[model samples]
Target: MPAPEGFAYVVRGADVVISHHGRPVTTLRGRRAAAFLDDVEREDPQELMARLTGNYRRGNERQARNHPRNRGR
Candidate 1:
């Protein structure tokens, strides 16, 4: 959401280094790295990297917020 920001990546030989807010988070290699590169050119890089690094939401926030326990907050 919010057009994920502060995500950057680097191509290192056969590996792809992904960083968030300037800190290294995960690295993709071989087939994964190649796929990432190809997708980056056609998709939203920030969202892609966020998902790969486990930093993106799982689409459950709205439900959680509406749960009975969270009502009238």
Candidate 2:
């Protein structure tokens, strides 16, 4: 199927990254790729990527705050 307008994808080795207007929105590989393929048109790609990637970003923020470099102010 043709990509949605303003949305595009590129394959980097084993992974395919879906981007919106030059910003990488999400990555697809293995099961995630298969699962998202069915809902590509039905869902908001930006919202979906945010929901998925947001979790990791939150964790990284927590880890950074707890790191030794951040200790003692």
Candidate 3:
């Protein structure tokens, strides 16, 4: 799948607020917030935010599509 887009983050005090397409999605606090800030600088920020917000691909679509229950579709 293509990389996600429209993800942005802002640090607020000890928290990190994540947004997608201008809408708030999730917040990271304390250690998680610290780690995210560090990683975002070195990795693809959009993908990272998508992951943090549980919006990234899980690589299971093909499997799901091939499952017996879904095969008829």
Would you estimate the TM-scores of all the predictions?
0.79, 0.41, 0.83
lDDT of each: 0.93, 0.64, 0.92
Candidate with the greatest TM-score versus the true structure: 3
- Show pairs that collide, candidate 1: none
Task: Please identify model 2 stretches exceeding 4 Å from their true place.
Answer: 1-14, 18-26, 55-73
Question: Lowest summed-lDDT stretch of 10 residues in model 3?
Answer: 1-10
How far is 11's C-alpha from truth in model 3 (Å)?
A: 1.2
In model 3, which runs have C-alpha deviations exceeding 4 angstroms?
Answer: 71-73
Writing each residue's lDDT as its tens digit, candidate 3 over 1-73 gives 7879998888899999999999999999999999999999999898889988999889999999999999999
Looking at candidate 1, the ten consecutive residues that score lowest on lDDT are 1-10
Candidate 1: residue 43 lDDT (0-100): 95
Judge candidate 1 against the unseen true structure and give its global Cα lDDT, from 0 to 1: 0.93
Model 2: per-residue Cα lDDT over 1-73, one tens digit each: 2223456667676676877668887788987776665665689764555555442234466688889999877
Model 3 per-residue lDDT at 24: 91
Which of the predicted structures, 1 or 2, would earn the higher TM-score when compared with the native? 1
Residue 62 CA error for candidate 3 (Å)?
A: 3.6
- The TM-score between candidate 1 and the true structure equals 0.79
lDDT of 3: 0.92
The TM-score measured for candidate 3 stands at: 0.83
